[model samples]
Target: MSDSNTPDPNTSGAPVPPRPPLPDSGATGHPAPSTPGQAESGTPQPGNGWFAHAPQTAQHPQAAQHPQTAGHHAAGASFSAQPTDTHASRTTDAKVGSGKIVAVLVAAAIVGAVSGLGGAAIGNDMFAANGTSVVSQGSTTVTVNDPDTVNQTTGIAAKTLPSVVTISATSSSGGGTGSGVVLSSDGYVVTNTHVVTLDGASSDVALRVTTSDGKVYDATVVGTDPIYDLAVIKLTDATGLTPITFADSSKLNVGDTTVAVGAPLGLSNTVTTGIVSALNRSIQIASSAVPDSGEQQQDQGQNGESPFQFDFGQGQQGGSSSSGTISIAVIQTDAAINPGNSGGALVDDKGDLIGINVAIATAGGGSSSSSEAGSIGVGFSIPANIVKRVTDEIIADGSATHGLLGAMVGNAADAQDSDIAGALISDVTSGGAAAQAGLKSGDVVTEFDGVPVRDATDLTAQVRALAAGAKASLVYVRDGKTLSADVTLGELTE
Candidate 1:
């Protein structure tokens, strides 16, 4: 089996401090300015700068007050009458002010050397000081330098990237790949359900999760919801997992920094950066909006009569409710998303997940059998706020249900042409709340609790917002007259 460990190391960051320089010996046979202090003898001293005095030696007040040294005292030796070169030269140099100048110059040189060393050390370039050895083990490394490298943001990307996994699923007919964020140490992973189609593989679906080290593991689908299109999966023997951090998606706005990390086009861990293109964009899935007429009808030319009859049951029938548009609200982003990128994370600048990439608008029309269903700029993600609701329901009950009104309604445009206004109910469930409230299939629901409903979509949205078993007053248009009735909503069952 391949090692599941991640071997990538943290990138180089801040610098290190410089090392202290080696002390040099002076020609006069004296320790090179041990510290910044005055000489021990009671003779007048020449050099009087900050660095001129040896800090290690005791200060002589009389010598400091005087401007010159009368004689030279070597280690346990005193110079006599006929002076040696050291004593004669010292006397002449001290008298000419050369002794103090030379001492000050040497002190400055030492300080400069120390400063340069410190700079190189802090610069984080271990090679700058001298080519030192680097010790590394399992994604961690240490480099020896003259000083040390202090990092504030190191280890973050390395720690988080490994936890980010690439997911691929295969079925009998086709396969898909995406990315997922590990949500638990025991192997719970969150990804897009569209990445792994149901395909009757509820228990037999094969999944492969690849870590940063190129190691692959067999994974299993935990549960998924087609409504939200989010799925959770697990792998065996998983531990020490790093879960992704979540950000408040409601607080995000257009122009915010959006960074997508996913396996775009099967390229694992591919990262792309962009901004939120548009918020609350309405997108429609053709399959969801237009149902197939199970029975194919012969071409009837431009009579505009669709073979299938759409029954609007507590939901909006396909018609331009307003502004000639028909689709559910969605979040639009410009971040690069591909067919394989579904279920990957759309994160903020701080690395917090904001959304899950779901679908991209196709180019022209029809589906391509090629492997490259990549983003052409426009991409849509299921809003986290909505996904949260769907996920909660799916986890608790294994399915999501909408509020049911028990009335069969038709599209506003078709009803308008038929001289009907509001929701034209074609049928009502027997013994249902509407039937018990003295309502019939021909009644047109025009309002609810005095709130005017322009079309079925607005009514469904408002009614679905209410919890099941809630009482609502319904107003309908019957034979050019307005009427009202109180009815309790029913639980929607799949």
Candidate 2:
């Protein structure tokens, strides 16, 4: 129960067991300026499980244990950041993990900091003054003319910040703070599950939410989808709150302008800018970082607050080793996401919510964890499409369902079939969707549901992003011949 800034490793993401390293993508990027680093921010909380096929599910036991290399993985290492609080002491917080050439899909609580970030933006003129001020009276009234023009970044901040809020969690175990996006005017909001649950340390944790306009409200967990590491909370008696606009993440492209709004390192309403560094990235990390395996119902949270939704026990999910390694498809950005940025908004140029900020890639390998978690220009976010889908289901039934491919897969690169880049099928579950579609051993999946399949990680992530029983098409190659099939996905099982 120490301050969340420097997390408590044992409570958050305990060290992961040894496994084979993911293949390096040779990813590279300019390091975030050292002016504000993750060193002092806090430990990890959704994580680099010390830590992607981070929803990394495949029928193969070995594939579930070890994910293949992601061509889109960042250069160097991956780590998780936990949310930090405003507490003066950051001692003994969450754990921030790292992996060579992979982002540790560490749960939230292994957060990073954004100290001096606003100053850096000011220096870069990102938050430039509206216009020069005119001085008329020294003591009485000062004359200031309106700005002739507003920069895109400045306008974006003005438009989006009000919809974002700072979330503080409290319990006997010290409290933490993370960011969230207001989804409805009546106070339904979305954030990372790690932020709400203190990276799974205490389900009984209480939450206090503060909006950009200085409004505070007690909130309760409506429901949580730990498989995707996302959660929904409702502000008590809240009304007239600004709801964020959602963008079609499937339509996004690399290099598009991205603005991240969150409370990074407890810095509320903090805004940072960068480009969509990459897209359709399948990052696989240990599932332990994001536990609960399925949907969780809330009976109560934070002082007599009634739970928002009734748990019917209708939605239960697990496919990736019952909390082993999992793979997730994320949008990569250089927008300076720190530990506390979990559950925050990654918006497009138009202030539309395109993704939810999640994890940052710290510099470390499988051997040891980063000293702390922060931004390194390599940050990850859950796509807006998934956010919308999961949030809708949570709001409707207090739970969500994820699609399953029900196949054992490995990297096509491992098969040395250089002719095509895809997920090489080793085995297909009997009576499973894949098997019903005529998929079998020795088949290479070239595409799924119209999305290209680069490897097992990609396939696993795409499958988990959708719901069970969804009909989708697939393309594969067998014996150097391309094949196609229409398949109905199955429900993921523990």
Candidate 3:
């Protein structure tokens, strides 16, 4: 189910407010471009935002933003819940044959042949007709092999099903169902933060996890990183449980076999198979946040705020002005991940967990209404590498930290217009990592560590992949000369 606040794609009856000009950077002399695809004049140009050459007056419908909340509830009811039909019946017929007549006939023939020898044989035929007869019986045995063979889909499912669990979240307002992956034998399970939070609020929500073996246990939220759309939960009294093996997501390639195991539409232990469609995909989804104590305010940024100012196209519609939402990097897959599949396992051919199945794109678009939809071959999963890093920190410290570059970067089109092929730095935070590395506002970041920074989004994703406080080598263009710098990353703070 998509987020209730997501906008519908078919209707264009309402006019969107005109976007404001990009914020001016003081002392830097460079203003951020308005749209990633066009210049400051708002003219249509070839770029990444939406329409690659749409007229300034032309208003294109926004792409539907699906939140991938599989267990979304509506007004105290489950959106994916349905009445289950369990009554089934079968009929069989049996056939019987009479052997008495056959036995009597055989005795009569023997007696007739023996009658020539003795009259006593004739009396035996009459006795056989009135006496009990011998019956013949046959038996046959069949052997069936187990279907869960190694290297097959069934094998993957069998190996991973024990670690994949169904999650149920309820509140006084409503309840819903999703899925989770066991991260530890002592009850640590990883899932989307939205799965347990109520309407993006962490308070007043109750969570429970049901294992594949039909065991249910109450769960407590250990910690959640809303920016990553990941949360860690602990199952009460859980021990000796099976945990999934995490594969190196960095080793995954396109066309590698992927198997998704989850409970779609409340169906437990369901498995779907496909191949890795793409990687390093950035998607925007709504996130819930609780206000600080005694804080009373409204109209926080619609797209929310990120420590590393990473902007991806237009902000998705459907979030309230006060509600916080953020974009996250994900692994794209053609696997049939659907509503109720959130927090499930996306495993590789060897049954090792590569990603956590999260949101799925749908054809119907997203709305604030109470309708639910299925996947359209475009599903996104949180890479297992990030999952491991974030969950480990949560398990130890009750919160997770992300690496930040402390610079406001421009989009790809801005770089192209500047005749550069890297991320353009429009502003650098005072005393931040970028400033400490001698990076000025006009400098264009070309490379970080060893990976090329193609655009602002690309740079943000790479920084997030690393741990805070790690050292990184950066190459940038200042004036007409290129320079390199070694700097320590900064930690993101809320």
Winning model by TM-score:
2
Q: Candidate 1's residue-wise lDDT over 313-404, tens digit each?
A: 01101122111111223456676665445556665544455666655554433232233233566766655555455544544565444445
The local distance difference test score of model 3 is 0.55
Report every candidate's CA lDDT.
0.43, 0.55, 0.55
Cα lDDT, model 2, residue 264: 57
RMSD in angstroms, all models?
Answer: 29.5, 18.2, 24.5
Q: Kindly indicate the candidate among 2 and 3 with the higher TM-score.
A: 2
TM-score of 3: 0.63
Identify the superior model by lDDT, candidate 2 or candidate 3.
2
**lDDT minimum window of 10 residues, candidate 1:** 70-79
Off by over 4 Å in 1: 1-163, 198-203, 213-215, 286-329, 367-373, 393-491
Q: Kindly list the per-residue Cα lDDT of model 3 for residues 324-397, writing each as its tens digit.
A: 44545677777777666777788765566778776666454443122534556777777787788888888889
Q: What tens digits encode model 2's per-residue C-alpha lDDT throughout 1-494?
A: 01112332345446645434544445544333332222233211212111111110111111111112100111000111122222333221212121011011210111122222233332122212334332111111112233223234444565566667777765554345667788887889887665665544457768788887677899999887767777888999998776767777888756556778776545565677877777877666543335443211110001221111000000111122223445667887788765456677787655667788765554432211334324556778788888888888888888788887767777777665467788887777799889999999888898888787888777888888889889999999989999899999988754
Off by over 4 Å in 2: 1-146, 289-323, 366-373, 416-419
Those runs of model 3 whose alpha carbons end farther than 4 Å from true positions after fitting are 1-151, 290-322, 364-372, 479-483
